[model samples]
Target: MVANDPITGQGANGAAKAAAVHLESILAHGDRPFDRDFQQAVADRVREGARPVVQWTSAMLEPAPEHLLGLLVAAAELPSAADRFANGFDAAADFGQWFPDPEGAADHLASLAPRG
Candidate 1:
């Protein structure tokens, strides 16, 4: 399938994830023919994994939101936070865990903060 441009930085990441999903699905098929069901299942799995990354990249194209901006600021000061943000590009599924909303981002940032 054709994909978006690399401007949002998800082209390579999404391709890698799709490859992994295909590999896993093929392995799991285990002697079964790669039939229509198999193809559909693979498509579903890849779509599930890709949805968050797609959403995150779409949001990024818009003006930055408050919580996203806050997370960026915190990432500058917290190595863990920065790493977490960077890691999302590698495993965009993680974006689903913490990138969608203000509360999740704040909690993630707080957890990355150093103790007194």
Candidate 2:
């Protein structure tokens, strides 16, 4: 998986733009099997300046699978979370077979932050 190029030329707020891009990429690949509500809750927390741990646990209104939840939490806390997720997914032989609904996942992730 090619690492995302650092976001640049966004003027004085380059760091925020880069962070946003990183968050988008991470959420795109990392959110699997979780519902839109969960994804949105995390994205909202991120936009609202919440810590990664807070973002991870913000949207748990009901029971979720423990292992999957742990993955999401860990990914949220890492700086290179998106690259790690993409690499892991690409390395897994059965990943494509297991997740045949990437379009749906992308759509759900997109809904988290609509373009103006």
Candidate 3:
């Protein structure tokens, strides 16, 4: 069964994505038999889509680094930054652009600073 950590707070989101994958796969298969191969292919597709989300969720489980904490604080005061972070929940892959390391996080925060 396809399942994910509920601690990630993505159970509903993941289920929705899985349902879409299943429906798309079924439609694309046309009259093909629902055999083990087809099921495996669908599972693989789901895993591919979910990989980034899982990575982000796993990261969240770890203790936050100072830079990450800074981002959180900035997010509270910056509406745009907060929105981007909120959007990341739906587009978890976006987290990869800036959420993984100190350098990326710093760069992202800098970008969010108001240009003079």
Tens-digit lDDT track for model 2 on 63-97? Answer: 55554454455457654444444553223222232
RMSD of each: 1.7, 18.6, 1.5
Question: What does the lDDT read for residue 59 in candidate 2?
Answer: 25
- List lDDT for all candidates, in order: 0.83, 0.41, 0.88
* TM-score to native of every candidate shown: 0.87, 0.23, 0.89
Top-down lDDT ranking: 3, 1, 2
- lDDT per residue (tens digit) for residues 1-116 in model 3: 35667777887898899899999999999997999999999999898878778888888788988988988998999998999999987988888889888999999999999999
lDDT of 1 by residue, 76-100 (tens): 9888888988988877778777788
Model 3 scores a TM of 0.89
Clashes of each: 0, 0, 0
lDDT of 2 at 30: 72
For candidate 1, list the clashing residue pairs, or say none: none
- Among all windows of ten consecutive residues in candidate 3, which has the lowest summed lDDT? 1-10
The TM-score, computed over Cα atoms with residue i paired to residue i, of candidate 2 is 0.23
In model 3, the runs with Cα more than 4 Å from the true position are none
Consecutive 10-residue window with the lowest summed lDDT within model 2: 1-10
